[model samples]
Each structure stands twice: as C-alpha cells, then as structure tokens.
Target chain A: MKIGAVIKISGLNKDFPGGVRALRGVSLEVRAGEFLLMLGSSGAGKSTLLRCINGLVAPTSGRVELNGVPVGAGVKNISLREQRKSVGMIFQQFNLVRRLRVLDNVLCGRLYYNPLLSSCFNIFPQRDVQFALSCLERVGLREKAYQRADTLSGGQQQRVGIARALVQQPQVILADEPVASLDPKSARTVMDILREINQQDGITVIASLHDVDLALEYARRVVGVREGAVVVDKAAVKLTPKDIENIYGGAKEQEVYDGTYGRLEYVRA
Target chain B: MSELKRPVLPPTDRDGRRQSGLEKLLYLQRALIIGFVLAVYLWSARGTNLSLPELIEGFPHMADFFSRMLPPNLAILKDLVRPTVETVQIALWGTSLAVLLAIPLGLLAARNIAPHPTLYATARFILNALRSISEMVFALIFVTAVGLGPFPGVLALAFHSAGMLGKFYAEAIENIDPGVVEALEATGAHKLQVIAFGVVPQVLPEFIAYNLYRLEHNVRQATVLGLVGAGGIGFELITSMRLFKYPDTAAILMMILATVTLVDYLSSRLRARVI
Candidate 1:
C-alpha cells in the first residue's frame, strides 16, 4: 500500500511575530492516498503544518513541495494563480460565507478556473454550476442549496465545507480540526464521510484529531506530534501505549474511551 | 474541611493609603484640566465681541424681520420646481458617484484587504485629504473650474462624500469575519476572488445601508452647494434674502425642508429593507 509521496516537506520552520516559534525544524512526507491522522494536543503545530502544505502559512526556513512544485506564501510556486489547486482544506469553523446561499458558496470553489471579471460579476459557467450542484449532492446538501449558509446546523455546515472542497477537485484534503466544533454524533458523521472519500476516491486525507479512539478507528496511519516534532510514526495498529502517551503530552494515564466516540476520560497513572 | 485554612486576603490598608494619594493627584489633575479649559475660553473670548446684552437688544429687530416674512408667497412654488429638482438630482448623482468611487478606495484603504502597506497608506491619505476639505470649499473650487452649474455641485458633493463613505466602507471591511476569506484563499482563489466571494457578501448589506444614509445626508448638502452659485434651491434662498423678498425666501425654505424630509423618509425605508 506504499504510494509515492505527494507532499514533501523538509526542515519546515515557522516563526511568527513576537518570537513565537510555531514549527521547529519539522519534516514530513505525505504519501498518495494515505489516511494519515496527526495526533497532537492544542498548539502542537499540527494546524501550522496543515496550513503550510496548502500554502496558507509560509515557512520561515523550509521547503514544501506539492507534486514536486514548491508552494507557500512568497515561494513563487504556482504561476498565474494556479497555486494550492491540488490541496483542498476543511476548517474547524466551516468558514462559509454566511449570508450567501449554500449553492453560491459552493460555486466559489470554482473561482480559480474563471477569469477575474466574470467571477466578479457572479458569472460562473453552466458546467461549473452543475459541478457545484453535484458536489452538494455528494455531501447530501442538494436540498439545502438555496438556503443561507448560516442557517445550517454545525454538521450540515461542515458537510457544505466538504462540498466546497470537493468542488476544488484536489489530490489531497487537509482537514484542520474539522470536527473540533461539532458534537460527538456530528463528529462520527464527518469522519465517516472523510473515510468514505479517502477509500472510494483514493484521494489522500490528512486530518488533525484529538479524539484518540476515533483516530484509531478511521486512520490507517498515525503520526504522534509533541512540541512541534513528529515523535511517533507508525501504522495505526502498531502504535503502543507509550505512543499514545507521547501524542497526549506524556500523560502517564490510561485514557478511557468512554464507550461512545469523541469522549476520553483519563485515569491518572 | 473546617480547617481548610481560609486564605488570608492581603491587607488593604497599605494599598488604600497609596490609592488615597493617587485620588488626591487625580483630583488635582481634574481641577487643572477644568482650569485650563476655562483659561483657554477666557483668553480666546477676549476679542470675539461676546456681548449677550447686544444679542438681547437685537432680538426685537429679529422679531420685526420675522413678522414681515409671515404668510409665505406660494406663487414662487411654480418657479422653485426646477432648482428643487436640480438639488435632488445633484444628491442622487453625487451619492451614486460616491458609492462607485468608495468601493475601490475603501478596499485599498482597508487594513485587512489592502495588498500592500504603501497602497493602504496612500489611499488613507487621499480619503483623509478629501474629508478634511468641506463641501462648501469643494463647491467653490468646482464652481470656479466648471463655471457655475449643478455639474460642479454634483462634483463637490461626490468628492466630499466619497471620502466619508470610503472610510466607513473600510471600517466595515476591516470588521468582517476573516475565516470566510481564509477559506476562499485555501481553494487557490486569487485575491480578487476572495474579496468578491468572501468579503463582499458579508459587508454588502452594511455598505448599502451606509449609501442610503449618505444619500439622505447629501440631499440637504446639495441645497448648500448653490450658495457658491452652483445652481440649486440654495441660490434662490440666498437671492430672495439679498433682495428682501422675504415671502419668496420662506417658500424656498419650505420647499427645501419638504424635499429633505421626503428623501429622509424614503432612504430610511429602503435601508430597513436592506438590513
């Protein structure tokens, strides 16, 4: 099941203003069609890593190559606005244009293909509209196409976010805490959708999750991160209790899975 | 549980003593500020002919003048039709032009939307310069250039309102939810696409609301533009007063008031629909 690397990150370092170092000498390789789940606590640099891959955050000192083409802010990667086309993103906040109809928000995914003047005038091609409608159908939001985005529930909004990303037609999808703001049931629904998309479409899915049990159930590969470094990289089944502790910030406790998904109760060791 | 040893709050007397000193200082500072204000007024009012008695003595003369203007001549209503319409036209065109100009200038001046600091600074400076100059001054300047007409009046109102509208729009843009724009950028969309799809939807309602407010404001301002010979009801008012045609002046004033009131009502209703 070993596929060629689709994203090659080398020595990535991101130092924000006020001297806060978000990423420190991080390096990673994401293989094609790998269901890789990044396990980390808050501020473990997972979000920054995901952002760097999609060219949202520039590395202070590193290289991020998507399909062997360098990409990031100021990297001169994609000429003529072709950047980040291969990398789709799902956000924790869903980030939909709230006042816009769900269909229109989905159509914005095709903005990169249309010219500036036409898109500015809200003139998307007919094929693009059909494609967007299909994407909404895939996410089970075809009935909600005309409703304002803010009117949707959290789970529905995330589904719409998925539809928007699908409209981008990317090779890999980066979901940054995509279920962090969702309820447990909604979390399971979203994870199921991502798993299906990954397995059925062979599109790579990289997700950052704090729910250890859900990650174990859905992800084939687990990468444990601690303090901006990848401390454990192994097949999901191969990870030991120690790896779990490392992912959970060395808490020497047996993490109880609380029967239901998305619930973890730690018993101190 | 009873002997949990309640944490002793730190003694407040020491802090209170220090704060009492601070209070005394604050009181002194407040007195100094009030005294400074009083001194400024006292110094500045010395040569301004501040005579309440003179004003009281002049009030009877004002009453006599007002009595002569009683029962406004409704005959001038026919003549007032053109200039009043021109005043409204000036307001309509001026607001439209301001909206057109403000959209781009506001985008450039907005701290979040601006692509570069230099462009942001330049746009801010331009808007500030325009806002600093009053419409009266702008009308005088334009009247000189275009040689006295409603065109110059429109130009004056547009330039001045664009400055104000642009600032308001920039603030609206700056206050938008950034997550939407970030999502747009994540999809390989260009900057223009982000603005068009993300920023516009969020801010457009507020922008339209601001435009309605500006249009209502501009209607009143348009009447003043004719004071500099820019062609409106203001010229009629000023000329009637100059020639002591008090009845005609009252009619023109009423016409201006009615027009302003009508625009105010319509603009508010439309703004309510948008919001």
Candidate 2:
C-alpha cells in the first residue's frame, strides 16, 4: 500500500455497541480528484465507512491513511476533525443552524482557523467573507446570505449546506445522502452542483445515494455495499440494470428500478 | 343436532371481592405517600423549631398589632418617604452587583462553557454553598464584617442572588442547541468564542428576565434585612415598633406593600417584553 495513493483504507472493521457490525474488513482506495459514490441500502455500512475516513466514528480494527497521515490509531492518530475541516461533509438533513444568518452558518467552515475573539466579533477578514460570498454565488444563494437559514426552502438550505462545505476549501467532500430529502427537481439541481464542484473546482466528491439513476448520472465510479461488504465496484458506463438488481435485491414490485417510481406513485395516490 | 344438555355451576367468588384486593393495594399506596409527606413535614418543622401551637398562640399578638394599625397614619407618610427611597437604592445596588458577579460565575458553572469538569464542578460547588445560606444569615455575617449598614444588606442580596442566577444561567446554557455550538467550534473559535457566539445569544433574554426577577426579590429581602440594623425603611419601621408607635409602624408597612406592588408590576412588564 503506497502512501502516495492519497486516501487509503485497509482491513477497516467497526462493530458498534451491542455487537452490530456496521463494517467488516472494508478496504478501498480513493484517488485524488475522484468522484466516488458509496452506494448501499439502509444499514449497509456506507455511512460508517465515510465516518471512519474522517474520524467521526473510529474503526475497531484497521488503518485509514489520509494524505500519508495515519488515522484511527492511539493519541497520535490524524485528527479526523482537522482532516474533516480540509475534507468537508454534508448530511442528508442539511444540518444548518436554523436561527443563524446564512452567512454565519457558511462561515462556520472556517471555525478551525479563527480565534474565539475573531469569531465572536464576526470580523471575518474581508477575504474570508468574499470567499464565502463567492461560494454562495456558486450555489446561487448570494442574495440569501443575510436571511435566517430556516426561512429558506429545502432546496436552498441544501445549497447553503454546499456553500458551507465550499468555504472550507476541502480537498475531498463526503456527502451522506445529500439529496435524500429533496424533490426530484431539487435532487437534480444539487447533483448538478456537486458535479460542477467536482469538474470545475477539481474537488473530489464521494456522495452516498439510494437512487441508482442519480448515482449513475453524477458519479464517475460507484461502489455498491450490501451487509457491510462492497459487492460491486465499477465505472458508471459499465453499470447495467442487472448489476443494480443485484445491489437492491429481487423483492420489488418492478417499478422501483425505474427513476419515475417515486413521482408516479405519489401522483396516483 | 338433536337434544343437548347444559350444566351450570354455582358462582363461587364475588366480583367485588376480586376488585377489593386492588382497591386495598391502592389505598395502602396512597396512605404510605400521605404518611411520608407528613413525616417529612414534621421532621423539617421540628428541626426549624416551627411549632403549630407557638404559631397559634402568636395569633393574639397579631390581633393586637392589627388593632394598633387602625386609623391609618397619613401624617407619617412624609417621614417614611426617605427610608423608602433608601430601600429602593439598596435593592438597585444589590441587583447591579449580582448581575456583574453572575456573568462570570454563570459562564463558569455552565456545563458547555466550563470546558473542564473540575472547573465546572468547583464553580457549581461554590454557587451551591453561597445559595445554601439564607440571605438573612448572609446579612448578619456581612454586617459584622462591614459594620451594620445598608451596604451589608446590599452585599448579602448580591451574593445570594448571584448564586441563584448562576445556577439558572448554567441550566439555560446547557439547554441550548448543541448544533449551534458545534458550528461555532467548527469555525476554529476558542472555547471563549464558542461561549460568546454560541451560548450567550441563546440565553441573553432568559438572563435578562432572571435578573429582573432577582431585583424584585431583593427589594423584599432588603426590607427584612433592615430589621437586623442593615439600614433601610425596615430600620425606621423597627424603631417605631420598638418605641410602641404602632401607627408609625403601620405607615411603614403600607409603604412597603405599595412599593412591592409597584416593583412587581414593573418586573412583570419587563419580563413580558423580553419574552
């Protein structure tokens, strides 16, 4: 395992309290500038794998090396939080502090760098504020920076979440089901923004997705997990309906495979 | 489908008898709770030397005092005004000092802002110690140290109120949304910054309201401390009582009641606006 491979994992195992094994001997490599989609059903260890990479959840056994720094080992372990600052994460819930102004929420990305006095004063250096504004403009929410975060629509809140991550200037962005709470239109918009961030800015994006079409459309590479094991790892162009069926399993009413199923059922109901 | 025969047995246990067991258990539980409450009340009363018969016997004295309070002392109003203003001053100064002292104590006692367990626990212990002593006891001690004056009364109210408000402020800090704190932390702000940005804003309104309440409470306590020679309207009232000038004492009581009502109204309005 050459350290030059960037973010590398080997024999990662995690068993939560009560002996629920979320990940077992999970091993993978995430190269620089790679848009990797960690695909999985509920309880399939995709989130745990992401959490382990950033040190949010420690792996019971195994080594995660990020940028040649050892993670999840003793007191000297690479502080995933410091690493997390460099590598931004977005949640399925958007996770914005609703009472705060959108600009303040976005500026939280710089929390790891600012002093208490500075943050309290909110005297973000003009450059930092400019950067945050530019990030907002990228996500098309520049006008809403002064508004309370809770006032925004679901789509806008998710965009604000993206802007928050962007202000971190992350090398890698891990989005745990980023579009799970959005409508189909909003999901597409968020996915497009992620793809743009990946393509234009050259930031690596690894997002978890349940929608196979979404993963297919946005991700360059999709790694499927089932029961805490990576079952399928392939380029998007190589993925087939058969491979997806293998991922979701064979107990659906047929239309679940099609992208319009979520929309159609609600319309009919 | 032909001829079928049915046999019936005699009713053995009464339905009421079955339910009586449950009813008995409930009654026993209720009696146990009532007995426990009474036992606790009696135990505390005995320790405090608060005897019912003593209180009953004092009713006659209370009647005598009220009779002396008749034919309202309107003439004494001019004399009472000066002492009344002194009482208000004591409360105002006491509340201001408490507010100042409580700011640091409250932050230290707050679970989120304390950062270290030892520091937090120490702050909490100190606050608890301050709050455990009654304000009158505090006044007595401070009066000995500083020499009997409204200064001692003010100090006593400040220390006691700070203890109470510190605990409340800490609890308010604890109840805030952790998500906001985490966000502030993520910004690379120091512990103090997190408290300033994340914890303070959430609890400001509550802190303001609590301070107003403490001010209102201190006014009443200031009157009582005056009886211990802490200097206020109570000092004048106590002199009249000692001199058997019941009409003058009645005048002071009326002033105290009016002052209390006015302070209460103002505090409620302030609290309402804060909310």
Cα interface RMSD of each candidate:
10.4, 11.5
Q: Which runs in model 1 stand beyond 4 Å of their true positions?
A: A72-77, A250-269, B1-51
Give candidate 1's TM-score. 0.91
**Cα lDDT tens digits for candidate 2, B52-168:** 899999999999889988866779898888888889899999889988887888887876667567888899998898899888898899999999888999998989888998899
In candidate 2, stretches whose alpha carbon ends up further than 4 angstroms from where it belongs are A1-6, A13-23, A41-48, A57-63, A71-82, A211-213, A225-233, A237-269, B1-60, B71-93, B96-114, B187-189, B229-231
Which whole-number lDDT from 0 to 100 does residue A217 have in model 1? Answer: 93
Task: Give the lowest summed-lDDT range of ten residues in model 1 chain A.
Answer: A260-269
DockQ of each: 0.39, 0.20
Which residue pairs does candidate 2 place in steric collision?
A110-B187, A111-B186, A111-B187, A111-B188, A112-B187, A112-B188
User: Candidate 1 overall Cα lDDT vs. reference?
Assistant: 0.85
lDDT by residue for model 1 (B1-275), tens: 13567877668768646666779999999999999999999888877978889999999999998887888999989999999999999999999998899889999998888887798999999999989998899999999998998999899989999999999999999899877877888888878888999899899999999999999999999998888998788999889999999988888889999999999999999999999
How many angstroms is residue B100 displaced in model 1 relative to the true structure, after the best TM-score fit?
Answer: 1.4
Residue B261, candidate 2: C-alpha displacement in angstroms: 3.0
How displaced is residue B215 in candidate 2, in Å? 2.8
TM-score of each: 0.91, 0.78
Error of 2 at B190 (Å): 3.5
**Model 2, A207-228: lDDT tens per residue?**
8898887888778899997666
